[model samples]
Target chain A: MKKRKLFILIEGVDDKRFFEKIIKPRISSVYCSINIDTSAQTGNEKIRRYVKSFHKMGADYIFVTDLDEKACITKKKNDIHRKFRVRQDNIIIVVKEIEGWYFAGLSGKDINKLGIRGIINANTITKEEFNRIIPKQYESRLAFLLEILENYNIRAGKRNNESFCYFMNKYVSP
Target chain B: MKINKLIVKNYKTFNNLNISLDQFNVIVGSNASGKSNFLSIFKFLKDISFSGLENAIQLHGGPEYIKNINTKGNKNLSIELNIDFDIQPRLVLSMKPDDQLKENERFEGLGMTFKELKYKFEISFNSSRKYKVINEDIKFKGDLSKLTVGESQKIKEDEFHKGSTITFSRDPSGKVTFKTGAIQHFIKSMKHTQLPILPMQFVKVKHTELFLLEKAQELGLSILPPIATTIQNISSYDFDCKASKTATPISVRNTLESDGSNLPIVLKRVLNNPDTKKQFYSLIRDCLPFIDSYKTRPLLDKSIMLEVKEIYQSQYLPSLLLSDGTISITAIIIALYFENNSLIILEEPERNVHPALVSKVIDFMKDVSETKQVIISTHNPEVVKYAGQENIVFISRNKKGNSIMTAPKNNEEIQVFLENELGIEELFIQNLLT
Candidate 1:
């Protein structure tokens, strides 16, 4: 069977890192090609053109964005629809931001290895909060992010964040 | 001095060629289409200055290889260069022991007040397998031969005769002559050795000699040494990553070799200077952001090695452990910052470099070209994109197998195509530009 081609629109470099290092391996067999556009959020005009072009080329695409400070998931989805003409079904909203997804994958033992403080809820963790909780032993934020990704626990990720679990159930199979 | 024009005849794949050059040039061509051969011309002149002509020819795979095989008869090779002096050169008087005292007492040296120079030379082989000079000339917009050092005060007060030609020629009979307006008086004042003529003893001047300019410098003539020195300063490189990884001896750190074997020592020189050191590290950050700092250490055997510290790593990684891309880029940066050549030729600078890093490297080369001439040969479209189509020189071959070069600035069709919003590389890859 010929595998389907899927394009994932991402906000920035951090999202690219998450998809490439953490999420790509689990969903590799589902798509013949998976192109993660890290700079998809650069402008609404470019994103609109990309969405239309990909649709015309007979390729499926999913737009992923953070629901930060929005009243609800519906408001975030509506915002993307108005800005880029993307459909609600095609938009996948993270609970707060992609940085929180890094924390969603950490197990109790993984947290111990990271030498960080206790986390109350991974889905509620914003980018700023994650920065504050990063261990001082790491020289750079990139180093800390890489260390977390190196030992990422996908099963724990689906169990911790509702949005993450929804995304995995719809797009990936265990 | 920057060479503004070059004319090559009966050399390699070039039957007859003339091209105008700008400060920055990016030459593109398929494999063996003459990009490297074009770059080798500058290297050939440089080699002729340091190692003599025969050795330079040997280094380039011998006389037969350099001469164009397509030439029917009298297989002679000729090169002509037109140089623009950024500033007028100050002439130094090299007088006889008896005249030295008179020069100091009576004359302060004069300047060769010219704005442009044209130097040309041709060579042919004799039956003995030795190269012989068939013709040579150096013409410039200055009159050095009109002034005699004995009457320097009078000559200085008198206005200089400008727009004159100094001609050095050798006929097919092997007779050499140096002629210009009022040159008889100038030749009368100088000794037999410094008369700008090859002596009877050197009648069979070996193939391993630059008979005109180098000989003038050797004989310490007042006008030609500075020009010869400028030609000798030309350097070209295709840096070898493996050579750069090895340790270099402490004594040989003067200039970065063509292969970049002495990169550690050259980098050390850059670090010693505060301004270049800052620029070097900042450029490195732009190219390889993960690298935080670098240092050099001496081996036990009086040699040195280079090591770099990654952004979050506590230990410094030796060059041997570093990636090929990292070392090659580092060597390029060192060459740009520390090497003091008037003209620098880089062959395939994009080799081993990731596509992400090409922009910074090209930008740096463009920036450096402001002070000196930079010529690069590459096949990468990203390089062509960043270098801009206006700076491109496209080389191809003809039915006769001779190389044909076309600069986009000189081609009307290429200019019209460049006006479009589409990238020039798109057209280049489609073979439309040809």
Candidate 2:
């Protein structure tokens, strides 16, 4: 069977970069010769058109957008369902901007280490001050955080923290 | 013509790859994979080298030819053939700056424009003449004479009239031109045929007689068991193949075209040439070790027939013999006697011959074709086993037609694969396990 292509849309370039460096590389471990093209900016009109174009390019659309007030403010377009509804099985929406959303994705031993504070946010900080939170390790910290979400299998879901952890240990957890 | 090297850039499966050939090189790949394409790449290079870019481009359809890549994701294409030694040289070529990546521009107007190369170890250019010749980094102006090596022969400055069929090289300063026929002959001589042997169906056998006969004699012959050796002279002079009618027989000869189509004529030719005939008979006697008399005669109007003396059922059967046995023996003899000065590719020589005789058949081909590079693509593991260590090319395929040919890393791998796997076709299954 011809493998379905994965199309990704992000809230910003940072999302695209993060997913490429963190998520995509991890996904590549399980797949081979697959289409995983990505675009960014969740609610922007330009990004919507880009999403439609990628769908035309044979992608099973995925939206890794932030679920903050900015996304809530943008008006919804009409063709969102007509184009994206083609393949329901491969569609996914990831809400990654809430304060505790990153840690809300963790559970078990993962939660014990990273604690309730969630991933220390750097979005509000200026470029120079952004390093103040993690201070030393960059990739290792990112890997540790994402490993939490992957462990729960809720990286693509918004409200699946406790329930997702239950589903994770049931189906996906090693 | 002997090729020196094939430099490929973003060409299909090969990304910036260059293959060097010394006399002979065998390429193996899985089904639907790209071995033939690689060979055709050589063909395309030959076509483009002499045909002028315009005609060659048109014949290939368009820039699409250059833009079609394999799994390596390289669609853009460029190839450089260091062919001065292969057929012609004394030249170099490159695209003009603006058209570096454009195909139509490369072939615009007065046809395809290839950078003209020169042999003099100096760089010179004439903007008015639309040329820039330089010391070979591999670059040059459009000088055609210094193309062939040694005594540069003059070619009648044809404007790629024959396209890849032939092209001449020249030296403008010295008014020298290289001959193009040598290359033409090489192109014409490629092996083209596929029956029980090769799955692909086109290989050309060049014309070489005396040398091939001597080689075949060295390979030895096969003597069949008396009763099993029967002849059916069915190719009659008046038998209309279209009408399915049977008549008398035609004469048999001693040489075979690549297809073995003119097998009868080959028998006749052997009879006519005393030295070759003696070699043919003596070798067959040595290998078979059976008391036999063989002769060929031309029938009245249009055909040939063969007469062979053999012991059958304690009696004798002459002229009327077993076709399968005869054909197998005849093919080996013809292969040895008729192929020379080039590579000989055999399909399956293991057809009707018994398993015991297979080694002899292989040995015959090896003796005859080895000196000139014999390449055989076979499915019979016995043939592979008999070929042993030095010669063998394993083939397999991936989802993409791009082929991956690894030189076994070591022969032990092949041995292990053989001892472990079912057949070559099933070897790829190990990849899934890996």
Candidate 3:
């Protein structure tokens, strides 16, 4: 049997790493036959173009982007869908930023290991808050983040973090 | 010698990459995608052979900087090259953390190590960051019947050695003996364990009593000679020639300098040789038609100043007065004409030049590649277009932030896009090549 091809477009190398190293390993059994085409982060314009082009080429994809301080998830999702002309279900907007999802997915112990203590809300974590906690470097911070996630066996799904899990369950898995 | 394959691991940006080479290779990537880092591999090898491993690492901003950041704790950075000589010989060199050398080893100056096996070679650093040759082997390409008695004994001893392979310096007269004059010559040639193996010039391979050296004029061992010649001839041009325009002291130079600061001297030398001068002028005229002529004038201080004459003007103006684009193009033309049967790695030839001239440069580079191997690192669409899909290696960072190298021929979507819809440049601009 031929596996269905699922294309994924994301904003940066970190997001791509999350999908490949973190999410893919955990869901391989369920999505056994599906082929995933994850693109290197080329920027927002290229991501928009790729989403449209991949759709036209007869491959379904999930366009992942940050909410970028947007007030409402619905508004961000609608804007992305209308702008890129992608299906509403195919768009996954990370609240505030992808770091927020990372914070949400990791347990209190894992968060403490990352040097953050007493974090009340992971979902509402802003980019600034994340940057304050773990500064960025020329080397992707995600390399370190993925290492932490792997050590704890923390899966990137709805149970750990809602937005990431939603995309995994709804689009990534068979 | 042409490199057929290259494998790099734990090097900057590259986690583990294997790239096949072509006569003319154009490497394109986004910023920080490791295009220049990839080209630096050639320079790195040349530097190691020329100035030993510690100096090479130090010159390149230390081991910490050269080693890939994403590599987990204590992983060794390695580069393996398969060069097509008489027979394909694979050379592997790995740099490991060197915090463990003994006090005596530390005091034993210029820490560098080299290990050689029949077709395999390894070099690593001791605990004190000093390099030492750990293993050396010599294996023949064909059947065991071809092996001399000494060569067979050496192989057997190598197979039985428990620890690391026998070091050539430490075991000068160990169990293994060899009849292959070249292998014995290489083993006996090592005067110190601290010296690097690749820099045959300093190591004095030419003076050795190897059979190949005795018959150097006739029989050619494709492997060693090409590796030596290519390493010696490897030239890198960053095209920063602003300092060359000034009236600098003139020194006789047969080859162009890396930064082109000696452009006047090299240009003078080229003009003196009629064959090279004609080709240089023709290339310049083709690439920059506005120029009537260029010459060097000796100043009172014995320094030489370059002068360029515009076609419309009768009086020649100083080279310092010319635009950056003209000087850059002229330097490139000179480099292309002078370097013969060598590998040239150029970084971002499109910088500071007009698009039309950039195309001319690419065309000239293509022409040069017929006689010599040329690898260019560029982000220009025109260069990528002119080089075509087959000659280009697209480099991108994988999800793990590791630099991955890919070619259009290996990419199905890129092939489909090239065949059906857009050109290579369009596909590149759309970021579809990844």
Residue B10's lDDT within candidate 1 is 87
| Residue range B88-178, candidate 1, lDDT tens digits | 6534322334455454445433234566778888888654556777666676566452233554346443334456555655555545565
- Quote the positional error of residue B401 for candidate 2 in Å: 1.3
- Please compute DockQ, using alpha carbons, for every candidate against the native two-chain complex: 0.02, 0.01, 0.05
For model 3 the local lDDT of residue B47 reads 75
Q: Model 3, which residues run further than 4 Å from truth?
A: A1-58, A62-174, B85-120, B136-226
Off by over 4 Å in 1: A1-174, B92-111, B126-130, B143-161, B182-208, B222-225
CAPRI accuracy category, model 3? incorrect
Query: Which residue window of length 10 is worst by lDDT in model 2 chain B?
Result: B225-234
Residue range B1-434, candidate 3, lDDT tens digits: 45667877777788888889987899999899999889887887777656655567788777677778797765656666655443333322121123533432321121111222222223343345443333223322211111112323341111211112222111111122223323223233322232123322222222111222122223233432333344657788887868768875875564777788888888888888889778888888887888888899999998999999999999999988999888888888877767553778888877878876767788888888877778989888878777889899999887588998899988765665565445688677646567
How well does candidate 2 score on lDDT at residue A82? 50
* lDDT, candidate 2, at B18: 54
- Score candidate 1 by TM-score against the native: 0.63
Which residue pairs does candidate 1 place in steric collision? none
What TM-score would you give candidate 2 relative to the actual structure? Answer: 0.38
Q: Candidate 2 overall Cα lDDT vs. reference?
A: 0.39
Error of 2 at B124 (Å): 26
Please name the candidate that would achieve the greatest DockQ relative to the true structure.
3
